[model samples]
Target: MNDLVERFEVAFNQIHQHLKEFNGYPKNDNFVELLQRSKLKHSVIRVHFDLLKQYAKLRNALVHERIRDDYYIATPHLEVVESLEHIKQTLDQPPEALEFATHPVIFFKDTSLLTEIMTAFDQQGVSQFPIYSKDNEFLGLLTNDGIVRWIARSVDNNVVNLAGVTAKDVLQDGLNPSIEFLSSHGTVYELEERFERSLEEERKLKAVILTESGKANDAPLGIVTTWDLIKVDRRNEDE
Candidate 1:
């Protein structure tokens, strides 16, 4: 009784410290918001707080209720942290670097000449391009905006080469259509919200590519787009 209570306190203090360490942006939020909020912006701190509360609860149960001091009680909670760490790792990694889009990107030779634009549109893939060079080297990315801009500028200028456009020319960088995936198998209201937001926001795809489990060069197994995210999750909603 007393032992469990004391252990819970110590564990809670650790939890508090960990949660507070976030600097209160999504002050108490877990890596989920940590991934989304773009460096712990304070407005969403309550979300983090909610996650920490849950994390603390599980941690207490695992440390105090489940495991005896003699036996290291490593159950789902420890695994939860590890799982969250993995989620953080995957979230921390840029989506482009993942090589998991359902579509392959088309590329041109360089930045100067508008020889051509490669597209997966023929294949019916995501609008973003993960470009490569003729030499098979990684090159800058092209976005729908970049393509549109190039089309708009083609009349006035001839700088439609691959080098002419880069990920810098488009893409919000830290901002893209994404949602956090939990390894433990779960779904949440927030996931739906992110998808809805992605749908409502322009300059990006209606689908939030969920990169959960797959090997290198893996395409997205499941995607939640605006339609599926909102009301039309079936035949009408497969964005």
Candidate 2:
């Protein structure tokens, strides 16, 4: 009995069951078919689609080519088994978005003064701030890039009246800052997908504001920026 083969089989079975459940357990489709279908709807599956397909073929060979109950013609490498297990765990319990998001999100109202906004940027060390209206409706994201643009414009035109400028006014002057909303329960995978989609569409996303139900009207619960995703990638590499 090869331990690596045993572990691989267990992990593969778990993944198969999960994907089956994800697709409502369609009886006619096989494992690979189920995986192909799931890849369309699940980010985890989509990201690992090719590797998963290879694993499926390996699983089939391992099961069908066994000489006997206690004998085998092929054995899985330890790394292969580990990778399968890791994917299974990720599918079962992915990290929540809020886990890595900046909590107690520092936001500004559209009417907030430049002085107050700058103070926040200095004190909080945050580049992006969610701007809302007086009625608390989300208006736009205020980014340091936008502030720099506003300042550059002011300096270029020799109009340096910063005292009276408001956050909304700065936003209008700044290079349009892009943002999206995610629910409190959103996963890190979803956040990464959002950023990836934005890039594909040629619109860079500045930040993702987490809310109660992923709506603009809901108050922000946390914030996830590109820097946060970089940290997450680094952490994954270290692990």
Candidate 3:
């Protein structure tokens, strides 16, 4: 029982220290209050906060109450201690989804020339480009398939002005591109869930764009694809 109590306190303190560092030292010293405040600001913390609170209460009971030593008043179950440890591990080293994401994403204006778009694709070896409006509002994704379809249609119509064609033209011609937006702090688990949702819905999600506020208008911090997730899993396995 003594060993269990010590282990539980150690795990709890580790998480508390991590939260302090993560939040830049909040005013509150209470663990539950700190977690509640963090959850209000971060979606990542909110997901596991309730479980953390429960464990915190258990810690309080074990530390404050003094029952018969022989009876082992507060025997911390192994699974319960392991759960707290898992939460600490998650908060300590969040899945490297955002870190592994492709950064400095190649985006284009809706009126950007087809030649410019093609050059970007050739140079970057990128198939998807997030297009924006004149006012810098996110329009949609422009994929290689959309470009090919546009070229095929233009050739059939004997349109010689390929240079004048723009991303807007392709969009006007009914290009359906799929995209998902998530905050830069999102975990790899959340990213995988989004991909799974896309698959279940049978929708082709071209990319998952990460931004400061997860808003489309904001400049993307990074981008993730299904391939990125696979590579992450493979790297973890190798490790």
Candidate 4:
């Protein structure tokens, strides 16, 4: 019982101290207060907040209501201790977003012919391509949805011309090219939060483009779509 209590407290204090140092929260503030405030800045904290809150209450009972120095009134279960330690380890080294993202992203020039894109789609099974200018500046995304829209509008008497159309032309048809950018170092948890936030704002976040600096102008490193978010959730569940 004493060993279990000690392990639980060790994990709890490590997590609390990490949250404080990472967020620069005052040392005088309580664990719950620190968690509530830090959750806004860290997706990991936000995701595990309810459990942490429960742990905080248990910690108070174990510390303040002690029957003796060697015997705690509340002896934490082994499962609870291990759970807290796991969370602490995650906080110490969260999974990077790029680890799950589609990397070496296939991109096309705005002037690239739609025929080429269609061929790549067939051969690579890729649904979207980031269209860039000759200078390598991102113009928009060329998606299957956008291609379908273009095809629908381009059907002139049941004949659509593909030779003259460019990737930029398909982009102009219908698909929302709006994208969010994430830094290469961003965590998987933060990527999930960004997608959720976009849905909450009622905006169609086409995809999250990973850049070296999380800026639109920076060259893209990878991409994360809603489908990728599903993968993240699945992996979390498996873990």
lDDT tens digits, residues 172-206, model 4? 66565678889989987678668767767888788
| Residue range with the least summed lDDT across 10 consecutive positions in model 3 | 230-239
CA deviation > 4 Å runs, candidate 3: 1-88, 91-93, 157-160
Candidate 2 residue pairs in backbone clash:
none
Backbone atom clashes (below 3 Å) for every candidate:
11, 0, 0, 0
TM-score of each: 0.34, 0.76, 0.62, 0.79
Worst 10 residues of 1 by lDDT: 230-239
> Which tens-of-lDDT digit does each residue in 103-197 have in candidate 3?
88889999999789988989999888888998979888888889888788778457656768888888788886778999888876567667767
Model 2 TM: 0.76
Candidate 2 per-residue lDDT, tens place, 1-239, comes to 38888899999999999888877789856888998877655567776778889998888889999889888877888888888899899878878889879999888899999889988899988788888998999988888878887788788467677778899898776466788999989987677778877877999888899998999879999999878876665554454
C-alpha lDDT of all candidate models, in order:
0.40, 0.83, 0.77, 0.82
* TM-score between model 1 and native: 0.34
Query: Which residue pairs clash within candidate 3?
Result: none
User: What is residue 81's positional error in candidate 3, in angstroms?
Assistant: 11
lDDT of 3 at 214: 84
Instruction: State, as a TM-score between 0 and 1, how close model 3 is to the true structure.
Output: 0.62
Error of 3 at 7 (Å): 6.6
The better-scoring model by lDDT among 1 and 4 is 4
